[model samples]
Target: MLKWIAVAAGVLLLAAGMVPLAIIWIESRQARQAGGMEPHVASAQPARRGAVVVYFSRSGNTALAARHIANRLDADLHALEVPEYALGLRGLAHSALDADARRNDPARLRGIRPRTLDLRPFDTVWLGSPVWFYSPAPPIWAFVEHNRFDGQRVVLFNTYNSNIGDDQIAAFKARVMARGAASFEHRALLRGRMTRQIGPDEMLRRIDADWLAGDAVRAPLTARTPAPAAP
Candidate 1:
């Protein structure tokens, strides 16, 4: 009887895992359909210590991190938006589908805010986003693709529940470098799962200790931390 119970448990676990995989496949097909997804353009300008922190957040983790960086650096802050990915389960489904779809086509972003990014003024650009489907969110990719980072330092940052794989990091780094960024670096923090989530104060403390040491490197941060699950 115990052996039979163990077999059933294993089958249940496998079924649970397959459910999401099936959902992802279905979402991918839908995303590929016409009127499924679209892209948007950002506005641009020039200006003259100058830095900017731009990010997109679904659960506010990345947004909080962005605010902390902006305050610490006295840099300008801009938020990216995707109306389709609003705050709910449906929104989350859309986000997951978009991330999955991006693995192939990398669709242009639609309904994202601040249509333009003026890289001329800022010497350093900090791009922040939450990791989705083990990758940088689609909006971030669209923003990066639409802009040129010539002669400026580009730093990528993320707030995640689990980990951003090395391959994703390497790919993002290559993309930024290809865009003519003078330099590139990354920083990330693990906030744990939603139940035992890390608070804003503690998260900032980790950021200070790990990334924002002083005026010297006053630039960027993102990485992987062992955690219960994903965000």
Candidate 2:
């Protein structure tokens, strides 16, 4: 009887372990298949003005959105890098722990290298990050803390797996606004199974519509230029 009980316990543990692995496999397979699609290219001409996209992506979901936005606007793109972590699931877990520590104790967070960014030329800045435990990723905090956005229009974009990302977006907005950014706006994308439910083109259309509408708070009259006529 004891032997049978032990066998049953072992089987349950094995099944528990296999569940997460199966989920990971399915998500990865779907991502690879979706990767073959040619991303929608924005036909509209880029704004004839200074704009830039800066982002940190872990699973590449945020990177895809960043690329789409940058391509649509024809803006300069910058990818934030950290030396401590590698890419993939292991790196994601490592970064999440790091972000949690930073949230609890801000002083524990370290600054990123390759620190030089000249924000002077750009009037508009698009900041992107993947959500980490209801907070912006650690690298994002490092970058935003070290930079000044005075007199700039700042837009926040985030990618998340399950959560709606309200807390993450709010936290990010408060930080950048405190740094003297002139205006703040945001957009969030749901990834994984949620994305598969909505379809990729729907996501693209939402992003494009938000961009065309200038969804953020109004920029100062001087900073606002009329968008170029669509070709």
* Winner by TM-score: 2
Candidate 1 lDDT over 80-111, as tens digits, reads 98888876557767888888888776564555
Which regions in candidate 1 have their CA more than 4 angstroms from the true location?
1-49, 107-111, 214-231
lDDT of 2 by residue, 1-231 (tens): 999999999999999887656645654654564455445333343455467788886555666677777765656778888766445456545776797897778656655654647777789998888777777777877888888899999988876766644665677788889988999987776655533545556665666666535533223223557788999
Model 1 residue 227 distance off true place after TM-score fit, in angstroms: 42
Query: Which regions of candidate 2 deviate over 4 angstroms?
Result: 1-5, 19-49, 110-113, 164-167, 192-199, 215-231
Measured by TM-score, how close is model 2 to the native structure? 0.73
lDDT of 2: 0.69
User: For each candidate, what TM-score against the reference?
Assistant: 0.72, 0.73
* Deviation from native of the Cα of residue 97 in model 1, angstroms: 0.4
Instruction: Provide the lowest-lDDT 10-residue window in model 2.
Output: 215-224
Q: In candidate 2, which residue pairs get closer than 3 Å at backbone N, Cα or C atoms, i.e. clash?
A: none
lDDT, candidate 2, residue 104?
79
Error of 2 at 69 (Å): 0.7
